[model samples]
Target: MSDRMRMMVVMCAVALLAGCAGGLGGGTYERAEARRAMTVDYGTVESVRQVQLEGTKTPVGTIAGAAVGGVAGSTIGGGSGRTIATVLGAVAGGVAGSAVEESATRKRGVEVTVKLDNGQLLAVVQEDEGEGFSPGERVRVVRDGRTTRVSR
Candidate 1:
């Protein structure tokens, strides 16, 4: 492919990878979660702390990047020079792609500690979106299997 075509492919790949990132906010729910039964408990927010949620590190991004890079690099030179360029491009692309994926998937979150009406203390971490939580505020702790979230 031409250099321009290769560049377009790379851009499209990056866009696709970015679009694949899903939100973890309390307001966001997986399709499988719909119609599922969940448990709810009342509690008072004891504390709220801002936190950073790490992003996913899947091979899809790295592979896609390497492929795009190799294609782009192949257009650089001839013979051994071209081979070297391809390898370097693939390596650089892989690293950049991983970083991009991580940055794209990362989210702002909060660690909320709540005191249940029964005196049980619990802490839940979830993406910080929609209703914000504050100390001494009444909230609901919703649980679906291993997943838990705090909301008003």
Candidate 2:
């Protein structure tokens, strides 16, 4: 074969080999499902508490607002007036920053309850899902010291 034809054949062989190696780990994940005989229970929310979530201090809106307000305020006056303008601009920027932060930090409450199989209930408010239990669902309750894990 010519030099050009020989190079083309080699490249084609390499490409075919790469393609064959690409699909080696393509398979389905299988989990064994089995039923265990245990007690199933229910609960109710006794009280709800408002919580403030921990989040990033720097939100896009706060940064954008500060930038725009600073530019606008700094341009509003000349000389000493410009100094006053910048200070005022910083105050406005702070207010805008806080508003943005508060909105971002707003938290949602998850209701946690302890239920006995004999229809008793106790509720608590927590940021994390307590025992991974949802409303009106059957779960396997594993009890440890001051904590629980609800499994299906």
Candidate 3:
């Protein structure tokens, strides 16, 4: 056998051995399978009440401010000016009334806290009873697209 041929055989054996040992350092040999897990955060439902608001309600602060301003504005004028001032006052009162009703309506709702299985917490205000969720229970969290929904 020629010296050059023997060297070539030795190099090929070494290369094969190196290839076999490539994945020995905690490296995975195959692609890992991905999985989906559910996480539920728990919170109590205080009350399941219906909150209704007329479409015409205005905010309270605006109404209160307008009332005070109108009263003050009325004081600045008398007689026909008073009539003008009263008209302005009536407009202001209507605005104020609507605002007050809106604020009151806005205050009616339920607050719930949901805890995810991943230890993340969320606070939610839901108008309807969040279906299948209870005050002290574990819920399965499922991811739908980009949003998370909880199920009992």
Candidate 1 stretches greater than 4 Å from native: none
lDDT, candidate 2, equals 0.47
Q: In candidate 3, where is summed lDDT lowest over 10 consecutive residues?
A: 21-30
Candidate 1 matches the true fold with a TM-score of 0.92
Who is ahead in TM-score, 1 or 2?
1
What is the lDDT of every predicted structure here? 0.85, 0.47, 0.45
lDDT value, candidate 1, whole model: 0.85
Who wins the TM-score comparison? 1
For residues 52-110, could you state the per-residue lDDT of candidate 1 as single tens digits? 99988888778778878788788899999999999998998888877777888898889
Sorted on lDDT, highest at the top, how do the candidates line up?
Answer: 1, 2, 3
Query: Which candidate, 2 or 3, has the higher lDDT?
Result: 2
What would the per-residue lDDT of candidate 3 be over residues 23-132, giving only the tens digit for each residue?
11111122331354434344433323334323224334444445544554566578899868766865775566455544444423334466655566755443333353
Worst 10 residues of 2 by lDDT: 21-30
| Deviation from native of the Cα of residue 75 in model 3, angstroms | 19
Over the stretch 53-91, how does candidate 2's per-residue lDDT look in tens digits?
Answer: 443344444544454455556767798998788677766
Alpha-carbon TM-score of each model against the true structure: 0.92, 0.40, 0.34
Top candidate on lDDT is: 1
